[model samples]
Target chain A: MKTSNKSVNQEAKNSFSIKGYFLRHIQVCLASLGRICRSPVSSLMTIAVIAISLALPAGMHVLIKNIEYVTSGWDGAAQISLFIKKGTTEEKVVNLKNQIELMGQIDKTEYISPTSALEEFKRLSGFGQALDALDKNPLPAVIVISPGIEASSPQQLNQLVESLQDNPIVDHAQLDMQWVKRLYSIMDIINRGVMIVGALLALAVILITGNTIRLDIQNRHDEILITKLIGATNSFIRRPFLYTGILYGLLGGIIASVLIGLSIGLLSDSVSKLSSLYSSGFELKGLGVDGTFTLIAGSTALGFAGSWVAVGKHLGKIEPS
Target chain B: MIRFDNTTKRYSEGHEALSSISFDLNEGEMSFLTGHSGAGKSTLLKLIACIERPTRGQVVVNGVNISKLRKSKIPYLRRNIGIIFQNHQLLFDRTVFDNIALPLVIQGLPHREIGRRVRAALDKVNLLGKEKLYPVTLSGGEQQRVGIARAVVHKPPIILADEPTGNLDPELSAEIMHLFEQFNQVGVCILIASHDIDLLNKMNKRIITLQQGKIIYDGHEMAPKSYHNHENIQ
Candidate 1:
């Protein structure tokens, strides 16, 4: 009975110690955060540095996502009209339109009469007198064909053009796609550039946090010596510093998030106006929940890791002597 | 309990602070360690505390060869011994209550237990009412008392006080010595090192005096006796 009671008491003590360890960590975290709070100016300045660091990547991320959203439904290549000879009549063009529409892969077919073709040329090319001076209207009755959406890929459209070129009645096949492909490649390069910048900035953030924690450990040398002398475990002594790092990172993440949001807000009007010049009302995007969470989590993790590394190195140098 | 066998601590540039010396301090007994400034009194305390290991010797504390102990076990050993510094290294940033409660908090006592024990320790040191005051607000002697209160707050088995009253007047010094006596009466083994012969004569405890890295005397306190070529020790 006595042995059983002793073992039971031992179990209780073990459980108590476990609880004590966890609660002690909470107290340390609180104390660290409290110290930051007490020094408001320095804390804000530190947080602002973090925020700026996080903002660079976060802002780029928003811009990329917005660009993706804007260009999501755009087609790289668009079909054009193939003008027939002037001698061709409405019957000739209608015959060609009907023939093209009957094809399995053709999306749309339009037949323009000689008179309508002449009016379109005058309006589009601004050559009304030349369009009207001709005795019998020198323009051709044209047949325009747009490929099926499913068959709109570059290879498929090329095959369709080849088939069109083989037609005896058509004069030419055309496409308006030169500038679109260039724009796409430009966007791709920019997206990759943004990712590289983000990675480099993340490294800078870690270095900032590590150096800050190093200074903090130096400042608290006396406290650390006292703590070690009193039998405080290394983990116990390190907890508050780690928490301080985490706080700095989290606050910085928040600041960065806000900065990104405000930047997006400020840019939204200008971007929309610019998009309108392109006849598109594309709006700039703000950071969503995942973005906010990533900023916070990434910054916090960096803070924790930086402090851990700095504190571990510096803590070893402190001799209870 | 502590034992140092053939302990030789040599610093850089060929300075052997403590020569090949040996001694044993049994458990549950009060003793004093005294020497000149460089005679290694503090070094001996530091070695027992495991703050610094002997350069070439074995240190056994509480039946365990602590000198051979791993780095991980150092904290456990320290939790069992309380140390008071000559400068009374109290944190100026913390209140006297929080300062006294440091060791207990480090041990992770419950909040109420921390409050009760810190108050009790402060009461013992006669600094009860100044618990809320910061260390900077306290006098030199009061700060030292706060340090003493913090050292005893966790109720360690052994207490090492290095010149606990070196900076105090004789009246406060005796009062501090009486406090140590009260603690000794409660079965806490204490080792104090000091330079005040007047206080040492009045202490009336077992005294161990050191001179030039050697134990010149170890005996019950009676009266000052002239010794050949030894520094005045208290």
Candidate 2:
């Protein structure tokens, strides 16, 4: 009975120690955050540095996404206009349209008879009187083929045009691909630029955070030595600094999110107005929940990694000698 | 209990701090170490605390051979030994209460237990009312008292102090010695290193004197014909 009671008491003490462990970590986290709050100017400066670095890439990424959205909207109406051979009858043009429509790669195909094609051109061209003086109809029957929505890339559209050009009755296949290629190339360049800038800025964030943490370690040099002398584990000495880094990272992430949100809010109105002028339904996209979470999570991770590196390098050098 | 068997500490700079010195301090015993400025007194204490491992030989503190102990186990070993520095090493940023509560906090004690023990330690050191005051606001003696409070708060079995009263007046130094006596009465083994011959002679405890990285004198305190006999020093 005595041994059993002793074991039970020991178990209680063990549980209490476990509880204290978590409680201590929570206390350290709060204390570190409070320290940052106490030094608002310096903390804000550090956070601003981090936020700017984060926001540049994140904002550029959003811009790229919006640009892609606009381009895709423009590409939706893109079709390959295949002018049928002049000697071909309207029956051959309709049959070609039917055949193209039945093709798996074509979403839909429309056939315009020679008379209607000439008539529609005459109505819009403002050269109607001049065009009526012609002895024979100059316009050919045309088949306009829209590629499947799955063919999103310019390369895919070009391939569709190439296939349509191979039709025997087709005299010419025309696709306005210059603008599409330019848009894609521009987007590609910007995307790569964003990645390079993001990577470099990410490295900068790590170095900035690391240097700050190193300075903190130096400032708290005496405190760290005292704690170590008093049997504080290296982990205990390291905990507060880690939390400080995490706080900096989390705050920077939040600030970047806010900056991106404000910029989007500022530009969204003009962008939508311009879209209306062009009869396109494009809108600026802000960092959504996932984006905001990723920003914060990513920054916090950078902070953690930076501080981990700093502490691991410097904490071992300090001893209560 | 502390035992050193032929311990030696040689720094990376090729300077030998403590060389093949051996000593045994039993449980609950109080002693003083005396030496000149560079007599390896601090190095010996540091070795026992596991702050610096000995270059050669073994250190067994409280039945554990700590010379071979892993770096990961150093903190656990130090938790059983409380050390006081000459400078007190109190953090100026925190209040005396937090300073005194450091050891217990390091142990991850509950806040209530930490509060109870910190107050108890402060009461013992006669600095109970100054808990809210920062270390910089305290006098030399009071700062040393705060260091003592921190050292004892965790109730470790062995206490080591390195020139703890180095900055205090004779009166305050005696008072600090009185405090150590009070702790020694409760069976806390203590080893204090000091250069003050007057205080060492007055305490009448065992004296272990070091000279140039070696133990030259390790015996009971012997009183001279006159307590002020300067010629009989060392």
Instruction: Give each model a TM-score.
Output: 0.82, 0.87
The backbone clash count of each candidate, in order, is: 0, 0
Q: lDDT tens string, model 1, B54-83?
A: 899787766556656668657767877899
Q: Please give, for residues A1-321, the per-residue lDDT of candidate 2 as tens digits.
A: 234334333433443466677888899999999999999999899999999999999999888888787677566567788988889977777877877777776677788888898899999989999998999998888877777667768888888888888989889999966777887888899999999999999888888888899999999998888788777778889999999988888999999999999999999999899989988777888888998999899999999888888999998999877
Total colliding residue pairs, candidate 2: 0
* Candidate with maximal TM-score: 2
Native contacts retained, all candidates in order: 0.48, 0.52
Alpha carbon lDDT of each predicted model: 0.81, 0.85
TM-score of 2: 0.87
Error of 2 at A45 (Å): 0.8
Clashing residue pairs in candidate 1 (N, C-alpha, C atoms within 3 angstroms): none
